[model samples]
Target chain A: MAENQKLCPMFEFAFELLGKRWTGLIIRVLLDGPKRFKEISAMIPGMSDKMLTERFKELEAAGILTRNIYPETPVRIEYELTDKGRALKPAMDKVQDWAETWLTPPDQNNGE
Target chain B: MAENQKLCPMFEFAFELLGKRWTGLIIRVLLDGPKRFKEISAMIPGMSDKMLTERFKELEAAGILTRNIYPETPVRIEYELTDKGRALKPAMDKVQDWAETWLTPPDQNNGE
Candidate 1:
């Protein structure tokens, strides 16, 4: 807030994690529940598979989400939020609230 | 959340506005109060003047903030968040809360 008051490095770090393109949308989808790779990809229309895969690895390495592998006849993989990831719900909700309040629907912007 | 449930275009738009590098920090600084250009730039380290100027224009165009010119000997200018920008406080606070809870202090992570 002040020139003398240092910005929290942790807050900066959080942005570094969540503020990238497609990252927030990925988290928003997961907020519903655990999703398979295809499921996650399906919900976000524009994200490339390569970017999604990279984000998955980053979230995994950061301990936000876990990848679970099922040893069925064909292996089934599910991605679920860790405790750390679930803790992000409140923040995500706030963003959603703000978005709903301020942003217009893309389709309705013909007049703009 | 569901694959069938379309992601809100508004949310995507909000992210498009806020998710850029240095944008959040600029908003965070202004959340304290209105500030002159130098004051805002002073608060955020490592941000170039050019980038700050660019973000300021973008924010103004988005109606997130306003630029006020005071007619003095030398024109005094200040940037203030509009109601739209002020509405972002709750969301920013939530992020700050999550960051404090989850992210390690930068200096303490020497072992990592």
Candidate 2:
């Protein structure tokens, strides 16, 4: 919105992607490496297949990640971050840092 | 969710706040300094008073910002970031930098 005119319009862009449900979590999964559609979805407990596909497509359109269609009888697709996507890691890192430092999230599953 | 058990639960916490509509914008306004309720809402074009109030309460509860009630002719209230709030700047900085470098936002109102 006004961000385009303001100092950090990119924050708006970044948020447009990350702000959606399962988007950041998808990226977080890829931070370790590339994964197929199912691999990414499995890591996030409650994400729907429809929602996961939406996030993947959005991230792909943004040039943050790419999809590879394997040349096989049954083509397989894997998603991986591009250089730009990898570059986004810093922001996520800082958010993680900020959270650990200042936040105490309520425990739900509290998986360990 | 899995964040609490895996790693970087704070990212989840940070996202829980920032991902909500108008939440990041509220924090962004406070970054400059404290502001009255009306002042913050004016900066964000279409933010409802209800939404702003909700975001303010959330951030205050998170300890990222604080509220002050000055006993003037009538009580004057302001919201300002705490040291913890200031600490969250780097994460936002990184996101802004990533956005500027890698993203091109569509312009609407284009306010400068």
* Best model number under lDDT: 1
Docking level of model 1: acceptable
Highest-DockQ candidate: 1
TM-score of each prediction: 0.79, 0.75
> Looking at candidate 2, what is the lDDT of residue B41?
77
Residue B87 local lDDT, model 2: 89
Candidate 2 chain B worst ten-residue window by lDDT: B1-10
Off by over 4 Å in 1: A1-9, A42-51, A106-112, B1-9, B109-112
Write out the backbone clash pairs for model 2. A111-B5
Each candidate: chain B TM-score? 0.82, 0.82
Give me the runs in candidate 2 sitting further than 4 Å from their true place. Answer: A1-10, A41-51, A106-112, B1-10, B41-51, B106-112
Model 2, span B52-99: residue lDDT tens: 888888888888899999999878999999998888788888887887
Give lDDT: candidate 1, residue B18. 73
